[model samples]
Target: MPPPPQKEPPRSFTARWAALKNIPPFLVMVWRAAPHLTIATMVLRAIGAFVPVAILWIAKLILDEVVRLAALPDTPDGLAGWWHSGLADHLITLVALELGIGIASDIIGRLLRLVDSLLQERLVIDLSMRLMDHAAALDLEDFEDAGFQDKLERARRQAAGRMSLMGTIFEQLQDSLTIATLGAGLIVYNPWLILILLVGLIPAFLAEAHFNARSYNLDFRRTAERRETDYLRQTAASAETAKEIKIFDLHRFLSGRYLDLSRKFYAEARRIAQARAAWGALFSALGSLAYYAAYAWIVVQTLTGDLSIGDLTFLAGSFMRVKGIIERLLSSFGSTAAQALYLEDLFDFFREVPEIASRPDAIPVPRPIRQGFVFENVGFRYPNTEKWAVRGLSFTLHAGETLALVGENGAGKTTLVKLLARLYDPDEGRILLDGRDLRDYDLDDLRAAIGVIFQDFVRYAMTAADNIAVGRIEAREDRGRIEAAAHSALADQVIARLPAGYDQMVGKRFVQGVDLSGGEWQKLAIARAYMRDAQVLILDEPTAALDARSEFEVFQRFRELMAGRTAVLISHRFSSVRMADRILVLHLGRIEAQGTHVELLDQPGRYRELFELQAAGYR
Candidate 1:
C-alpha cells in the first residue's frame, strides 16, 4: 500500500557506511571467498597492467622520429620506414593491446558475478537454519515478549540484506585489486599523479561513511514502529478476528488506520533518501574534478616535451579506468558497513538463546506416576503483572480422588489446574509428588503424568484418528485405542454418522472435508485428551459444548474414566460438579469455601446461591 516504503540505495559514502563499527569480520568472509574470484580477476588485471607499461616504452621510441619526419630526404626506403614510426604506427599496436585488456576485465567481472551468486545461496541457507535452531531453544515466555519478538522479526526480514552485505564485500575486494594494479601502472608513467589521486579520495570516503551510519540508525529506530504496523495488519487479516469484524462491519475503519501509518512510514523514508541524494551530488562533483584535472596534467606534460606521445596515450586511457575502480571499491566498502549494521540484529538474537536447549542433566522422563501429587500453599502471578491470579492456594489429590473446582470467570480455578499440570511454577510455594518438590522431577515426567483438556480446546483440521493420536505422540498411539477413547468420550456416535467416518477431515476449509457441529467437536477434543493413559487428569469445562445426552454419558462414566488416578475438575454447571468427593468454590484469587456438595448446599454461602441459580436456569 502507498507504493510499499521507498528503499533507495545509498548515494554517498557517509550515507552508505556511517553505521559500521568494524569491517574486519566482513573482510574475513570476503577473504575466505577470494580464492575463486581473485584467480580470474588477477589474471585479467596482470594482462591490463603489462600492456600499459609496454605501450609507454614504445611511445618513447617513436616520439623523436615523429618530430624530425618532415626534414628527412625522400628516399624510397626512408619513406617506408617513416610511414611506420613517423605516423605513430606503434601507437596503434598499443591501442589494440589496451582493447584486449578491456575484454579481460569484462570476462573477470562476469566470473565473480556468477560465482558470488552460488556462494551467497549456500551461506544464506546455512545461516537461516542456524537462526531457526537458536530461536527454538529460547524460553517460551520470551516469545511473548514484545522486544524479543520485534528483534526476531527484524532479523528474519534482514536475510536478503545479509547476502547483499556479503556480495558488496566480494565486489569491493575485486575493485581494490584492480585499483592496486592500475595505481602501479600510473606510478610507472608519472609518480606525481598517483599522490594527487590518493589525496582527493579522503573527503569522499568520510562523507560516504557518515551517511551509512545515519541510515543504519534510522532503520534501528523504526524497528518498534514496524512491529506495530505488522500487528495491525495481522489484526485486520487473521481468522481469529474475522467473525467479530464482519458482525461490526469494521473493514473500512480498520483499513483507514493501516493506510495512515503506512503513509507516515513512507514519508520518513523519502525524506532520508532526499538528504542522501544531496550528499551524493556533492561527492559526484568532487570526484569529477579529480577526473578532469588528472587528464589535464597528462596533456600539459606531453605538450611541454616532459612526456612522450605513447606515455601521454597510456596515462589518459588508464586514468578513467583506475578512478572508476577506486570509486566502486569505496562504494562497496560503505555497502558492507550498512549490511553489517543489519547483521548486528542477528547477533543480538543469539545473545538471548532459547531455554528449550537440552541440558545434560535431564534424565529420561519416568513413564508413569506411582503416587499422586500435592499442592502446598502454591501462589502464582504471571511475569510483570501486579495482581496474583492465585494466592495461598493449597490442595491435594491422593490416588483415585476426583476433586471438583467450581468458580466464576477469573476465579483462579483454571490457574490452579495449570499449576497442577506444571505449565507454570508456583511463585511462593512448591508443588510436590510424594514429598519430592516437583522441580526435582523431570519436566517431561511431570507433563506425561497428566492429560489435559482446556475449555478452549483445539479442533485440529486433521483426520479424526490422527487428531486423537496427537495426544500420545511418543508411542505409535494405537488406532484401536483411539477408537476406544472416542467411545469413552461419547464421540463414537458422531463418528458413526460421518460420511467418511474416522478418516474425515475435521475442518471444511479444504476440499472433500466436513466440519463438525459444536458438540461433536467437543467430543473429539475430549477423546483426544483421553488418549493418554496418564496417572493424573484435568478437565476444565470439558463438557461446555456437549449436548445434554453426551454430558450425561460423560459424567456417568467419569469414575471409570478417572479410575486409579487423581483429577481436578472445573465447571460452572453445578449438576456435573456435584458428583465430586469434595467441592471448592473459589472467589477472586482464593478458595471461598470447600466441602462436600451436600454440606455446601446446607451452609448456603456462595456455593449454595450459585447452585440454586444454575437450577433456576433450567426452569
Candidate 2:
C-alpha cells in the first residue's frame, strides 16, 4: 500500500511571533556574509532617505520667495538692478540646490541597485555552500526520511529567495526614515493629520498580514505535493527515464498528474490573491480619503490666514509623502513576516544535528585489520515501519575469509551490508570491528577501511576517471592509481575504447557526454571498488550486469585479487557463491545456514534445492 501523505500542523500566534524573531538573526547572517556591500547599501540608502523631505522643504521656501519677489516693484533688466534686488541670487541658489539634490538622489539609487545585486549574488552562493556542508554532515537515515526531504526542498528555495526578503528589509528601513522626517513636518502643522493617516493604513496592514499568513500556510501545506510534482516532471522528461517513458507511453499519464496537482495549488493561490486584491483596494481607498481630508483642512487653514501658502504646500506634501511611506512600510512588514516563516526552513535545516556523529574522542579504525567484523544479535527496522529489515542476526566474518551471502529478494542482504558499513546502526545489538563497537571508531576512517560496491551503484555525470576516483576521492589526481584500479576491474578495456579514454564524459546530462551500455557502466562502477583498495571489500551482486564470460573471468581472478583482504559476496548466482570459502544462506532476516559449497550441496536443504533449480535452467 502507498504511504499516507504527510500533513503540516497548524501554526499558532506565538509560533508566528517566533518566526518573526528569525528575521534579525537572518539579516545578521546576510550582513556577515557580505559585510562591505551590506554596509555600502545602508550608507547610500541613508543619504537618499532624507533627500525627498529636504527637496519638498526647499521647494516651499523657493515658492515663498517667489511670492515675496512678485509683490516687489519691477526692477530694471541689468546686472546692477538684479544685484540690488538680490532676488536673482537667492532664486539661482535655491534652484541649484534642488537640482543638485535630484542628481545626488539619482546617483545614490543606481549605486544602491548595483550593491544590492552583488550582495544578493554573494549571499546566495555563501548560503548554498553552507547548506551543502551541513547536508553532507547529516546521516544517511535522515536523507531517507520524507519529512526531511520536504524541509530540504523548502531550505533549497530559501537559499535562492532570501535575497527578496533582504531587499524588502532594506527598502523598509529607508522608507521608515523618510516617513519619520515627513511625519515631523506634518506634526508641526497638526498632529491629528498624522494620526488619521495611520488609522487609515492600519486596516490595510492587518489585511496584508492576514493574506501573507494564509499564503505561507498554503505553501507549507502543499510542500509534499510540490515535491511530488517535481519528481513526476523529472521522471517524465529527464534523460535517465526518457527511454522508459517513451516505451511505456507515460507522457500523457504524467502530464495529467502534473496538471491535476498544479491546478489544486493554483486554485488555492488564486482565491487568496483575489481576496487580497479586493481588501487591498478598499483599504487603499480609505487612505486616499484621509489624504484628501487632510488636504482640504490645510486649504481651509490657508484661506483663514492661520497658515501661509508655503505652510499649506509644505504640509500637504508632507502628509502625502508620510501616508505613502507608512502604507508601503506596513505592507512591506507583512511580506517580511511571511518571508521570516520561510527562513525557519533554512535555519531549521542548519539546526538539525546529526544523530550518528562521532564522539570527540572517537578512536581511529585499526589499519591492516587484524580481526574482522562480528554481528552479535544485531537488529534493525526502517524508520516509520514495523517490519524489521534484519533482526537477531549474529555472525562473524573472520579476517582473510571470503563469505558469500545467498538470499531471496528482500531477505536483508543489502541491509546487512549497510550495517557493516555503518551507514546505519543496528537497533537491538552491536557491530564490532576488532572486538570494539563499530560506533567507537571514527566514521570517516571506518568507511575508508572498507571498499563496497552495491549492484545499484550511481553512474556519476562526470568523466570516467572522476567516476572511479569517487571511491578514493583524495587520490583523484593520481592517474596511475586510477589506471591500475580500472585494469583490476576489467574497466580499462572499456575506457580504452572510449573516444577520450579516461576523460570521456560517461552520462547523458552534459554536452559531449557519451552514454555507456548497462554492462559497460557496471564495469566502471566496479572499478570504483578497486580504486578504494581497503582492507575489507564487498561485492553485492556487482557483476549482475556483466556478460556471462566477463562474469566468469571476474570471479576466476576474484580470489587472487582479494587474497589478503576479507570479502563479503552477496549474490544469487551459485557460480559466484560457490567460490567463497563459506556460503551463508539467509532467510527472513536470520542466518539459515553456513558452510562450504560441497557441504551445503550435500545437506538437501534450500541452498541445494535452489542450486539444482538454477542448474536445470541451463540444461
Query: What's the TM-score of each model vs. the native?
Result: 0.74, 0.95
Q: Where is model 1 more than 4 Å wrong at Cα?
A: 1-125, 159-161, 187-205, 238-240, 299-322, 353-365, 448-450, 456-535, 543-561, 575-583, 595-599
The prediction achieving the highest lDDT against the true structure is 2
Question: Each candidate: what lDDT?
Answer: 0.72, 0.89
Which stretch of 10 consecutive residues in model 2 shows the poorest summed lDDT?
Answer: 1-10
Task: For residues 394-502, write the lDDT of model 2, one tens digit per residue.
Answer: 9899999999999899889999999999889889999999999999999888888999989989989999999999989999999999999899888999999999999
RMSD in order of candidates: 7.5, 2.4
User: How well is each residue in 1-619 modelled by candidate 1, as lDDT tens digits?
Assistant: 1222323334555544444643565445444654555455445444444444444444544454454444456523564664655454554555566566567657756765676666677666766776788786566557766667777887787754677776565456556665666677788767877666655665676667666667776667777777777877887776657888899987887888878878887888787778778988887888888778888999998999988675676677668767776777776665667676676676667667544333446454344555667778888886567788999877766667788998888999888887776667788888877767776766766677788988988878788777777778664357788898888888888889888888888776567777788888888888876788787789999999887877888888777888767788898888788888888889888989998999999996899888889899889
- Measured by TM-score, the strongest candidate is 2
Q: How accurate is candidate 2 locally (lDDT)?
A: 0.89
